[model samples]
Target: MDSAAAVSFDANGTIGAYQIGVLISCVLLGVTTTQTYIYYSRFPEDPAILKALVAFVWVCEVAHAICVAHALYQFTILDYGHAERLFSRLPISLDTAVFFNALIEQSVLGFFSFRIYTLSMKLYVPILIVFLSSVRFLASMVTFIITLRLPSLQSYNAHWSWLSIAQWSTSVVNDVVTTAALVILLYNRRTGVRRKTIALVDKIIVWTIETGMLTSATAIFMIIFYLTMKERMIWLGAFTVSSRMYSNSLLASLNSREALRSMNATQVSLHSFVSRPGIEILQTTTTNTVVDITAKFPSQPQPFQANRQCEEC
Candidate 1:
């Protein structure tokens, strides 16, 4: 935020902080769009609900970008050089943008809750995650209604700033808890599992942490700047892009499952010395049971006995 620019609120819709936030949000929308295309291309076999969620989030992002763009266009172009229009109270377009954030957050949180349920094999963490997500959504709704009820933006902020705080605070807490739970769940899976399974778990844990940080950090930044920089609109852009982080994080995970499949397909084996006249190697085939046979030449296929006897025995 430039010292001179912060004071100058002419055209470009307060081209100091709010302008940057909207532009950055548009950039993040592009990032998420690329990830969405890759997800559709690479993971055609993904679950239908997962596909639907991606599509919904994409639509929400498109709508969100449009709303922000409309606000910019209205404030800067239509009402250019009007100091009275420097800071909007509750523009219709900006108001529309707010609920979209809640929608994206709730959807992403629900998706992760299901993931936690799958990985943790229980509902405690998932329930808590969903609860936090619900609280955020409800807070946004209350904020929206109060904004409509209040006489002006200043009045609304004075009366209902707590709603905004609650929304972002819950979002931050939800992200931290969800990420920690997933990391712990993945860590626990390493016990009594194959090296390949352990490697996959490690990858998931890394991914979970990275995505979690992206969302949590953005939300925290939004809250901090919103509170600390009361005289400026710098926090507006941070809030604008926060939803994109959640949307992209979920989409990336869905698309990156390809890595897991590839990892599993790369077979690994250990070598042993039989110490015969010539090197003897034993090949084992299993189907719910194991059979060991001693053969002079390892190249010859050892017949399965239990399977053979079970045919008539």
Candidate 2:
């Protein structure tokens, strides 16, 4: 076969799609690893289970990157220009690599599940989130099984696109539910809080929405392209990097807590009273502003530690 004919069975766009996504994912993976290190370095007080979960996330990401790299190696380098092998049989490595997508996503969702539980203290919301997450994971698992069963990539798409649809749609719904829960909870708590406390909570709410959107939007794009660009694998390509977005969002949330807390501390300190003796001390200015953090996070208030911390800040 000539050069053009060699790559014809699968278009160049389809061939390049996974490679491009893997490259993007690898870059974001590096960012996530760095952010995880930063979170550990900054917050040694974080729970042991939380630390273990972070390590698990790292391992899943590394394994995912390796799997995709190997699949690409099989497609492009190891079997270069072998159209029959490339086009006729689906690589099992791709099956494993895409399965990692479900793993990575569920890990992030698990973390958020606990967070939603903590923030909302409602069992039903977390239960629903967990159920949706499980649906996504199971859909991906079924998709992988279908990939393994089918020899042809074309045939697999024809047979199993429904599972991909189910997975991506579940992810989008889960993210939307989680984001709405967080934002609503935060906004509700801000009602009776002080100015500084309200500002801090507002910042939290913004980050909450932003991080939620990152994953939600990525999954939405994946599903849209999956439906529209059937031959190109554009959606699958986006799936590679989208997991990193979730990890980065979680790490950012963890790291930002400390940074924002410290910064808020400084801002609070600036309000301290100046010790200057004056001839006429009839009027004095006191910059120390007291806050009731119980009123800040009304449901799960850390009155002694958090309220006093802000007061001392």
Candidate 3:
């Protein structure tokens, strides 16, 4: 095989990295579908705006998957044995995929920002998050436009590297800020709470950290790979999967409400009877089972009261 062909298929090179990224992203798309389904089925009564956001993210993800698959097909199948085509202008599908990715990121980040607002009842922090997210999205869109005009992806790196840096740096900063804000707010809420409520708050903080870390870590590595190894498309691999992480994180957060509520109820039930054994303990459940962390952990802790059916028992 010629050197070009060999490099094209080199496991440590561009095509190889892109192929692997595509495979992982496709697998995560399946996960996205499942999470979307779970969110819709379980939380039918969620606020209309929240429901719309989930639907919009899912749709964008599906479109992104299709675009990514098309790009892969063009690279590996349609342009087989043509090394020049691999380095040629970007595929339309790939360009569209980037746009979809930006959309997904913006939506998910915005949703999280709103959640922070709900939790803290403060707009400054959430507003900052939204601002960062908007900048990232705008930069991505500008980059996408530039890619269309560039003769090759290599030329893009040559001319407008600063734009790429801006886009990715804002992304990393936004993720870190969002995660930190949620954790700090939740941690503050943890104070002056009983063991049961603290447990719930701790669980939420963990989830926020985990989800934030996954996306933030991916963004960090993406910029690193791009800056260091753009020639081999290593960054493309990370880019392909990054948007999916945001979507999954959002859905996972929404779906976890049920579990959180169940946990709170179990903790309450267990402790309510621990103090009064052999008493007929009848617990009344609230209809709102959805996990609203803001409601669960109020700015001021409310005294716990149990509605007992058998006070005379």
Top candidate when judged by TM-score against the true structure: 3
TM-score attained by model 2? 0.82
The candidates, ranked best first by lDDT, are 3, 2, 1
Whole-model lDDT, model 1: 0.68
Error of 3 at 11 (Å): 5.2
lDDT of 3: 0.75
TM-score of 3: 0.84
Task: Give the alpha carbon lDDT tens digit for every residue of 1-313 in model 1.
Answer: 3556446644332345677888888998999999999888975654465578889999999998998888777766776655555444657787778888889999989977876665445689999999999989988877766666666566665667777877888999999999998788667644544444445557767988999999999888878876776445666678788889999898777656544554432121111112211111111232111101111223333221111112111
Task: Give the candidate order by descending TM-score.
Answer: 3, 2, 1
Q: Is candidate 1 or candidate 3 better by lDDT?
A: 3
lDDT of 2 by residue, 20-133 (tens): 988998999899889988977866755566677788888888888888778778878887767556556677877887788788888888877766565555689889989999
Question: Model 1, residue 288: what's the lDDT?
Answer: 18
Q: Which candidate gets the maximum lDDT versus the true structure?
A: 3
Extract clashing residue pairs from model 1. 21-237
Candidate 3 — which pairs collide?
none
